[model samples]
Target: MLDDQLKSQLAAYLERVTQPFEMVASLDDGETSAQMRELLTTIQSLRSDKISLRTDGQDARKPSFTLQRVGAGTSLRFAGLPLGHEFTSLVLALLWTGGHPPKVEQDLIEQVRSLDGDFNFEVYMSLTCHNCPDVVQALSLMAVLNPKVKTTVIEGGAFQQEVTEREIMAVPMVYLNGQVFGAGRMELAEIVAKLDTGAARREAAKLSAKEAFDVLIVGGGPAGAAAAVYAARKGIRTGVAAERFGGQVNDTLDIENYISIPRTEGPQFAAALQQHVNAYDVDVMNLQRAKALRPASQSGGLIEVEMDNGAVLKSKTVILSTGARWRNMNVPGEEQYRTKGVAYCPHCDGPLYKGKRVAVIGGGNSGVEAAIDLAGVVAHVTVFEFMPQLKADAVLQKKLASLPNVDVVLNAQTTEVLGDGSKVNALAYKDRATGEEKRVELEGIFVQIGLLPNTDWLMGTVELSKFGEIVIDAKGQTSVPGVFAAGDCTTVPYKQIVIAAGAGATAALSAFDHLIRTSVPQ
Candidate 1:
């Protein structure tokens, strides 16, 4: 049930509904079912003239409800209470089902409408998952856009038996036509591209036809966004080609070190970054991954950046801001058991291990924070640190020490992950002090070691440090003339968001300086 403040907000949102809809409930004599009834009744009370609630329905899953537009073929179902992070998804579903147009691009809308197939999508998501809302909203919007598509969002917490049966240890697990489609955060564009086979070709053609930009950024995280904004302000053409707009920031949970803002979550900050970049006249090419880079043959010649889709974009100067990703534990069985019980995000996957023992690999801030957070939901947490002492802050270590269910082990090196060919069952490590091999029986393993730069694609192309980070000077210039680098991919000492953004600004300014000094080839 919603509070008075929430009800007031819902009343205002319901006014956007242009058409009438019904909430048909399929319930049984259960506590969750009773709560579902109350929630539906409360929602129907907000706009009784346009909304109606009906009980006495039969579906395999109790405590579920179906949203159907009156006299329209659009319909979707929610098999659990859409509270917490999914509340926005539920609101959008209601509005979209009632004929309220979504704020997405018209092209994406048309793509969904044009997709040919009978798609029955089922998504298992946790309420606390920050990434689940994106997938849920995407699928829900598709179901509303095309009649042949139907989506059912199931809350994994309410349906634990189903999650266990499927061995789903992650949130936002999507099943299309009863087959696993994907897991993790997915935007509407990504989903449509997967469904529409010709999307990549069309996008490549479109990108290839674009004109040369004054500044071309290779990533769309904090650095790329800042560079785009700064370059666009210089009255020159600017463009950003990115695999995903958020980059590694999308996987981040909390960000508090940014100067201006006191605190913000990763996804929210990423959205704000995209919005800020959109405010400028920069051309943004999303879902574009750069596979290769070619420097200009002569002064004033355009540098070419090739995409995985065969599209080549030319620019006067290229700013490589491709960010980093979570470093994986390369031990045997680690890759084999990924998503089967080995997860990188404790925030997203921690709830799945309720009352189960899990291990956190690392003793830094991320690892300690993950262990502290998981201690409340999981039965026990064991932390393995490769160093002799914890690298986490004093405050964090103090908090971690206070938890009774957490055990910290220093000088422990992870050797291998043990699984039964399907899911993780234990983790093997070596004691550096005693040279003793130890194995801990657990259900899940969260790796929080560090980050690996996204510069593997640029090997032999740029001057890279021993750690594979791009070698950059104070001005953010790479060894290759006309090609600058910034952010986590570069040799920046600190990998904080604020530092990346400042580095981005510096790169953009340096690129402008280079443009002014270089002579135009006649």
Candidate 2:
């Protein structure tokens, strides 16, 4: 039965509106008969000028109203307690009762409204992923912003077969207009831009080659490419799926230490890894994102992965080699000056500031490391530490102190990034100690603040640390049974390429073990 407080609340809200409306509800099986009787009685008491109430299964003949039965037989089911953010869905469902769709941004509305073609987007996500809420919110906001766009959010681990078949290794993957977009926690601006510009659509169309394999790996970083090589050597049919074939390594300018290769460039190292993976029969799907995953129903466990292009792939197992991206500064000019005078990874674009002035904003290990690295390449490196002192390791602090080109500014904060349209020229900062404002002329600024985990697409399906890193057990078991996580994204206390790669290997091996146990005949 409706609670007394809820009934009063509903009545008060109805009194404010003058238009005629009908109340439709999906009844719970356990208390339907009793609840319906109480609800009908309550509606009878509020028989006013325009409001009306009807029970379930009674209004099928009426075209204007619907009392849809939505429990077990319905396509949608509430997986968890509908509290907090989940309550938003309930409000939306109520608003739909008035036959009014949710509102969306005008630009997004226009784009979707003009398109007569069918468009569907299924986002794979986890709950604990830091970026998952943002991704879901962006898509949901888009739907609200554009009535023409329909979206479905799926929990990744629960749909393992579907993910494997679809060759999706990353979260927050968007399948739209029969194509895929692979930014985990994409900004709304980017989503709108892609829909409006069609640049992403064109890129998806360019990579149309297809092939078959037992295991398909996405991401050409150390994880994805390495999985392909390892899987191939194990006599399994392997293939690789990458947006750019070499992953993040392709963007690196210099790699001072990568095990056997002491001194190597990012592209050269990527080439070597690509060659090693390609030596086998592994097919590479370059510049492509897995758009959708459709798992086979039969017990044989075959999965089908649909790409941004029309091509499809069949695989028994799937390895996510999709690596993490450098975290952005989120400042005003950060986006505009990207690659022009602003960079995330010091190793990737530090040399561009050679003999020129540069600033490193952060005090963490990465920030300190970047400052130290830039000190050697650039004429002067000014490190702006937010905290009182450098938070880097003792060794790094000693090294940075010894360098003549490096200057450590304690308790400093960046206020604004000023750039001259073409590139960055200078920036304004504040000294916390002396309360003095200052501006420094520099050719480049590297934001080495910290990294944001790429797990935001997970949509609350797994456990995550407070900092948004995925929580995994010793063997890499995530909060979910079939799911495993590793690397910088996980709460492993370290964010290094070597650590990420090693974690990937552990996750793969754990997945393999789980596959063997699950696939064994009863």
Candidate 3:
């Protein structure tokens, strides 16, 4: 049940919505579906004149839903009740179905209008996933903006066969046609960028036979992009290739510590990176993953970078800036209850659980810091650690201990995420000392373990650290001449955006110097 405050807020939003729409909730008599129906009924009562609700009560499946214009054709689906962080998705969807347009960026609208041919996107998500709605909303708005595009939101748990076929282990798994588009919280610009035509596909295929570039950088994180802009400014033929721009920064929720900018989110910074790089005439080969590296000829020869698509791109010099991904807890319900009550980013989803009980998993600096940060927003914070003692720095530990609403638990191994077959309600763990299973009733959980660098494809090609980080000298040159690596993928100690961007500049200058020394006077 919504509190009076929330009810009043929603009532205000619904007052302006006058278009009639049908919310056809496909249901089973299960608790989850019943709860979903009740939620819809409640919302309907608030705007009974504009929004009508009914249930298809016997599908034997999990909670199923569809919201459509009363008379138009149906293509969008809300496979599960959009609850948890996805509650926003339901409200936004209702607005769209009721003839209210979304607030989209003008440039994004232009890109959507530029898309030609028919395109349909199927986004698989769970009601518990906070990251899922971003993708759904972006695609949903795209469908609304352009008649050439359409989208359907699938609930992963409700559609077992579809999930099995896709081998989905995470939420917000987007599929364009039959192939998986991308996963997690994708940005609106990225969705627009992926509408690659057949011409672009053929062009990428021919990269193997193209002339060599002066500098070719792999990875599109802050480092790779920075290097590309620098190299392009030097008036040399430059190219930047990566699976995605923004790298790990795209997953970060906030950027208060970054210099200059007082505050920013990952997606916003990533978009700025894209805009900055696109400002130059740099040849951006996106959606390409570096598979291996080898010399096209012998020593002092142009290098050939093999990509995942079997395309071999030739370059005089290369920079590696592939970054890292978050380290998952790998526990049950961790994925199932993600965004429902389980989250990895304290900065991204912390405010959503305001005044609610939450837990922070891990005792290292990251965990302790998350606990400290969340203590200010949440009603209470319980810190769980696998080790007997906290491993955080004394300063952070002291700060955490000072919090009145914080509790520290040592030697606790998180075993399961407990939920009511929907959103998370409690978390279960085992106490190492007492051999007792303990359950804590909390509304949210934040996991802050560590990060795993992306460098598996460079195996046997360059010298790598035991932990799989690439080895580089002060000049950013790898074991192979003309090959450079930077950012989290290299031996750079600090792994922050500011540090990576600075490293990129250093690498570009180093590559330019190497080119100047090696090139014969024309």
lDDT (tens digit, per residue) of candidate 2 on 361-435: 998878888888778878998898988988998998998899998888889978877787767888788899998
Residue 265 of model 3, lDDT score: 72
**Per-prediction TM-score, please?**
0.98, 0.53, 0.65
Q: Using alpha carbons, what is the TM-score of model 2?
A: 0.53
Best by lDDT: 1
Report every candidate's CA lDDT: 0.93, 0.60, 0.80
Candidate 1 lDDT by residue in tens digits, 156-268: 99999999999999988999999999999898999998999899999989999999888899999999999989999998889999989978888888899899899998989
Model 1, stretches more than 4 Å misplaced? 298-300, 519-522
| lDDT for position 149 in model 2 | 58
